[model samples]
Target: MIRTFGFPELLFILDGAKWTVLMSLAAFLFGGLLGLLVALARTSKIRPARFLALCYIQLFQGTPLLIQLFIVYFGLPIIGIRVELWLALITGLSLHASGFLAEIWRGSIQAVPEGQTEAARALGLGYISRMRDVVLPQAFRISLPATVGFMVNLVKGTALAALLGLTELTRAGQLMSNITFEPLKVYATVGLVYFAICLPLTLVSSRLERRLNARG
Candidate 1:
């Protein structure tokens, strides 16, 4: 029995879209926190800290995200730490995002004028205060465009969760296609849903870039 692609099917895909959004947000939130720490360490004066942070960034950036997902979803059980599908997916995505976001923020932190740091030092600010009150604020502004761009990529990346049996948007499409024998319709709808989610972020990234450049 081939069911037509109808409103119910569309709603099902949309339901999956919600999971996609939730996962992306969760990954971004956790990743951003860890990335900030990594960025700080990457830019630290301590050689060992910088070296370790560099290696951390390289490890994730060097590997395919799918491989990361596999390692998390499959490897953990071997170590006796079983994770649910959503937890595994979020963990893998967060780690991946942390590496990329760390680099983005490290560059942004460095891009802050050296004079700004000197001024903060001259004002007798300590390392934490300097970064918290002075450097990070500017870096945050500088990083907005790239961060949003990466977020757009992250949103697309969530589709990979389908491979791990998480019924995100792409997974939803997969099940729909299987049942309806309508891969074309199902995937086209998937693509449209992805576009709907990503286009605004894309536009925002571009706008932020232009604004930053204009200010520069």
Candidate 2:
């Protein structure tokens, strides 16, 4: 079976890889938008806002992604609201990623030197102005490596969406293997595609982090 791995099967796997990349990008972009709001809420002076952000982060992060997917895909219909598998998968992945990304960005903001904020305040910058002019720009430099790493993880996590019946790379590999009776070759191809997607990002992230550190 491994000896019989064909171009057709390999192409099918590559097609699935494209879907995985698309889903990952969707999850990351939507998650990043929500995560930024959550990060700001967590850092806000209002007690209720901070508490709400904390709860949002903790609830999602404390739950397993598989369980979250199940809740979205299966559990929602119980309330008379039906969601398509792809839609549910995207929602679950984005929400999960948002929780983690929020925390990551919050930590990055805190890692910005205290004096930067203080200096901004002394310059008569308001809260928003301080963040925009002084804190967030520097924090973004520190955050880029972590965000890239999270995106890689998010891409890997798209495989879990297959469990919800969204035909991603892993699910496509399973289907091909079942049809071809070539599990080893099929799975190996799947892994190679994933690595191909991830390894370059990993290298780029490492290089960027090094450059950032050197500049600082």
Q: Which residue runs of candidate 2 sit more than 4 Å off their true CA positions?
A: 1-3
Clashes of each: 0, 0
Show the colliding residue pairs in model 2: none
lDDT of 1: 0.94
Q: What lDDT does the true structure give each of the candidates?
A: 0.94, 0.90
lDDT of candidate 1 over 1-216, digit per residue (tens): 889898999999999999999999999999999999999999999999999999999999999999999999999999999999989999999999999999999999999999999999999999999999999988988899889989989999999999888899999999999889989999999999999999988787778778867885
Q: How well does candidate 2 score on lDDT at residue 34? A: 99
lDDT digits (tens) for residues 1-216 of candidate 2: 343668987887888888899999899999999998999999888999999999999999999999998998899999999988888888999999999999999999989999998889889999889998888888888899889989999999999978767778998899889888889888988998999999998899889888878987
Best by TM-score: 1
